[model samples]
Target: MDVFEAIKSRRTTNGYFLDKPLSDEHIKILLQSASYAPSHFNSQPWRFVLIRDKARREHLGKIAGRSMREVMAKGNFWKRYLKYFRFSKEETDKSGDGIHIDNMPAVLKPFIKYLFSEKGGEMMNKLRVPYLLAIDSKKLVSRSPLILGVLLTKDEYKKDDLSGMYSLLALGMAIENIWLAATALGIGVQFISLPMEAGGAYWQECIDMVQPPENYELIALFRFGYIDPNAKRPTIDWSSTQRKPVSEFCYEETFGNKWIPKE
Candidate 1:
């Protein structure tokens, strides 16, 4: 696929990938592609730990499941992440970003709407959505042939510092490079967001298990493998999976000054 096509068509895999494992050559190519991304002052502070061991992957999946349960048990899951779910076209239009409800599984759609109501929280807990989701998540993680763990070297950016900001920007570029390359190769990628959702204290356990090289901290985890062409389409519609119009976000010269491209 063309580079632009890959970039424009790339989508996050929210469902399970096929049982295929990425070849060693494929992994090497992805890492090489990522290494080519530009970095601040050429610092290139990113480090990657690739997890392919089934036992270790299962361990990570367990950690992910535990972390997910801990978050849902707080009883404020909807309140904390409400803005990130768009259930209708109007809602998606207004936000211009966030996960569209259509992308969610069919079984979860009605429950998602219920989540906004005062009683929905109770319903969610009653239905054990969190537990069910965790089970599904474990199946995904355990079955994925590869999990790429991204790390950043210590003593660089503090996230609030200027250099740190640049380093992060570079890291994003690196991630995109890998993602696009993988997309071109017919692979799918999904984030392991449970660690962040569960917070540092819990994430430390994941770090210990993954055992990244010394002097590095885990930044992100992404599962990658081939997609199943025969998989059923997700129940929710996916119109918003496409990028928002440039006019919605791009500005002419200042904030709130919309930019209109000429034909």
Candidate 2:
């Protein structure tokens, strides 16, 4: 696939992937793509743990579900990410940014905003939205054909050192390489983030399962598989394809200066 086209078409797959394992050849390409990413002075601080075991995926799935439930129930999800939510076409169109909450059960349509607010925890719990999300999270992770555990070496990931920032930037590029490669291969990727977001025993369990060495830290987890065209959408779903125009964000060298591109 053309690089530009692959980048434009890349998407976060929310529904189930085809119930098939990834070929060893494709897995090699994915890892190889990451390895080729440029790092600061070629420090190459990233490491990956690929999880394809059935029982292990199931256990991680349960932890993800429980973490999602706890985070939403405790209002942490809302407190942190409410700014990135768009409830209607009007809002989404106006912002041209942020994820649009375009799909949900009819019961949530009326109170979607409130139900996602910190103050609505009691009412949301009554409706069991968190429980529903938990089930969805569990099923999604468990059904995935692969779970990628991304890690960074502690030697290069020092928070106070200049190499710390360099390692993080390098890893971001590596992940982007993985994403673009997956898009070219007709695979889909989505972050398995609830455990990280919840940040407690749930997160520790993930660390234990990934079993990173003491010198490395597990930084992120992502589920991967071929896209399932006939897969159904979740009870609560969102889309973030909308993006702000370059003019809306780019500047003419100096900050706040307007930038206009030629047609």
Candidate 3:
């Protein structure tokens, strides 16, 4: 498949065929594509956990649902405050003595809405697809820091202190590769960052199940299966949403100077 076509057509699958399963060969191909994604200094920090057990997937779905509900119930107070302040700033700043105080909600409202929506819970439940792929990484650096030499010793890389931004970028590229492969194979795939909240626990359990490096962190999770033909697909606005023109995004030697013609 053409790379650009695959990228343009790839969409997150919500309704998956419950009984359909991807063959081992196809899964292997998808993983191989992901493995070839670019990494910084050849320090491939990503790992994958494939969950195929139905009972385990169902348990995870329930746990995710409960977590969603708990987060929503507890988060409403702040959500309401932010919503009120965002739409009614004058009312938000009113005081008993007519002295308007700056009582604006400090947090971003869109993030809160995402946390409280049913789509959030649905996204969690959808992780129960036929193949649940989880990616992990070492929390600490290795004895030899490959080509980068960014680390002095294994102890130098702390999960909290060490920056994994490049590692994450690589992982994202890998995920995109998998998505494109799945699209070509007529398979459904969805990526979830939900497991991040339970990453510590998940990695602890994984460590018990598999011999992992002394220090590692769970990075991402994915669900794969067949698309449900009967499901109602959500409509997407392709026209209004667009990438900024090259002129708007690129600049010359200095910032804000157009690098290309505006029109």
Candidate 4:
């Protein structure tokens, strides 16, 4: 399918058929598409670890399930139990630092709490699907104390923060390519961020099994397989979910100046 058609049709598939296995050839094509995604200075920083082993997938599911439950339980009681939880001095000290978190207002604490406490668990459990794909970044791309230091220039350090953003956007593009391919092939796929329970150590163990290039770091994971044809998809308002008019999002050299021109 063409790019626009793929973009319009792609949807997240959570429920998958465990019995159906994707062919090696199909998997190859999907990876090939991902590998070609554009990156900063043509630095192909992303690596994918495809997990086809049923036993390992099951283990991941169990860990994710438990992690989800814990997060949900904490969310349900966090407000009432706020007094019992201690806020670290380090966290408070870093609040005013010129980093991304510096702009966060103290009033948003409850909202942040709700974000971490509530949806965090649901997002974790969403990882328990059929095939798990672990995405990693090359170590060379992120070896310094500052995560995006490798890509930042001395002159552009404070002004531009596009290095890491570009890498992630490229990775996201790769993911979209794979997801669309899966859709066309009648396969189901879900993108999931790693749960706190399956943190660095656990992920490192899984990555070691794949034996990727020495410079890679785990980035994201995906669960995929085939879905039952008879299953009903959740109803969504297409207009709300679909992209806004290009005129609304796009502009000329200056902000709000129409580039497309009034037709």
Candidate 5:
């Protein structure tokens, strides 16, 4: 696929991937693409762990599931991230960003707003919503054919210096390259992020499992596999494809001057 086409096609795989595993060739290609990202002083500081063992994958899945349940069971998750939830197409169309929660069990329709309300925590737990979501997360992740752990060399990712920021930027670019390459290869990718979000012991467990060397720090985890065309939507799901127009984000040479296209 063309580079531009791959950028346009790349998406987060929110549903289940195909049962088939990724081939060695595809895995190598994904990492090779990341190698091309520009790093500060040519210090290509990224490392990737290709996790293919079934037992390891299942263990990670359990961690992810528990993390989800932990986060969702608490009020802070909803409090902190509620602004990003768009309940309807109209909401997403107007905002041109953020995930649109367009799929849910019919039972959740009437309680949608309530579920996000400050008073909903008790009711949410009563309904076992977190448990259901945890189950879904576990299945989506554990059954995945591969889990890729992204790490950055501590030498370049130093916390006390500007190199850390530079290294993170380079790492972001490298991940983008990998995502685009995966798109071109017909592979789907999604961040296994709840463990990080839940933080505390949950995040530590993930870090322990990924087991980055003392010289490297694990920064991200992603699941990769062939896209399943017939996968069913989860009990609840969100899709974010709408993007803000250039005029909304870009500026002219002078700040505050909105970018406008010439007719």
Candidate 6:
């Protein structure tokens, strides 16, 4: 696929991937693509560690699952993240972001609306039933073929410095490059995001498994593999993810002065 086409079609795969390993050549291409992202002062402060070992991936999955479950057990899930969930189709259609209930599995869709409700959230928290979802997510992680860890190194420039901000932007560019490259190759990728929110100890354990360079911090984790046609995935109205017209966020030299695009 062409670059623009890949960019337009790229979407995060929801927890379902075929049990196939990516070829060495394809992997190299993705890494090379990531490396080409523009960096400030050419200080590419990002390092990638690819884990292909099944056992290690499984172990990491367990850590992610367990950590996620623990968070749910703390009864703060609704206050923490679920509040951001837009459950109704109407709500999803109106907003440009946040997860939609339609993208959820049929079995869980009914529960989602209630789970996000005030009384429902309180009751579920008391019951602590969401932990089961975490268990299944852990299995999904274990089955993934490739687990990639992205580490951010200590910048020569401090966090308060412009150089540090540039480095972060560059890292985002690098990740987008890899995602588009994988899309072009018909590979799917989904983030292993729980560890980051779980806590420092959980996050540290995840980084330790990858054995990254000293002082480098884990910034992101993801699993990539072929799509499993039979796997049930969250139902998403992809059109909702489309960007709003330029007039919405663009300006003509000053804020609030909208810049209209040529027809």
Number of clashes recorded per candidate = 2, 0, 1, 1, 0, 2
Predicted candidate 2 versus true structure: per-residue lDDT over 1-263, tens digit per residue = 99999999999998889999999999899999999999999989999999999999999899999998999888878778888888888888899988888898898889989987768889889999899999999999998999999999999999999999999999999999999999999899999899999997989999999888899999999999998889899878999888888889999989999797888
Error of 3 at 208 (Å): 7.9
> What are the lDDT scores of the predictions, listed in order?
0.79, 0.92, 0.46, 0.47, 0.91, 0.77
Query: So what's the TM-score on candidate 4?
Result: 0.57
- Which candidate leads in lDDT? 2
TM-scores for every candidate against the unseen true structure: 0.90, 0.98, 0.58, 0.57, 0.97, 0.88
Q: Best by TM-score, which number?
A: 2
Ranked candidates (TM-score, high to low) = 2, 5, 1, 6, 3, 4
Q: lDDT tens digits, residues 1-263, model 1? A: 98889988888887778888899998998999899999987888899999999998888888777777777756566567776767787787777787666655666776777765546777777767677667767777778899999988766757678877877888999999999999988889988888678887768877887687676778889999888877654333244474577888899889999998877
Cα RMSD, model 1:
2.5
Candidate 1 pairs with clashing backbones: 102-236, 102-237
lDDT of 3 by residue, 229-260 (tens): 78432211001112345676689999988799
Q: What residue pairs are clashing in model 4? A: 139-215
Tell me the alpha-carbon RMSD of every candidate: 2.5, 0.9, 13.2, 13.5, 1.1, 2.7
Report how far off residue 101 is in candidate 6 (Å): 2.4
lDDT rank, highest first?
A: 2, 5, 1, 6, 4, 3
Question: Which stretches of model 1 miss by more than 4 angstroms?
Answer: 103-111, 117-119, 232-240
Name the candidate, 2 or 6, with the larger lDDT value.
Answer: 2
Query: What TM-score, to 2 decimals, does candidate 6 have?
Result: 0.88
Residue pairs in steric clash, candidate 5? none
List residue ranges in candidate 3 displaced over 4 A: 76-163, 195-213, 233-248, 258-263
Candidate 3, residue 241: lDDT: 16
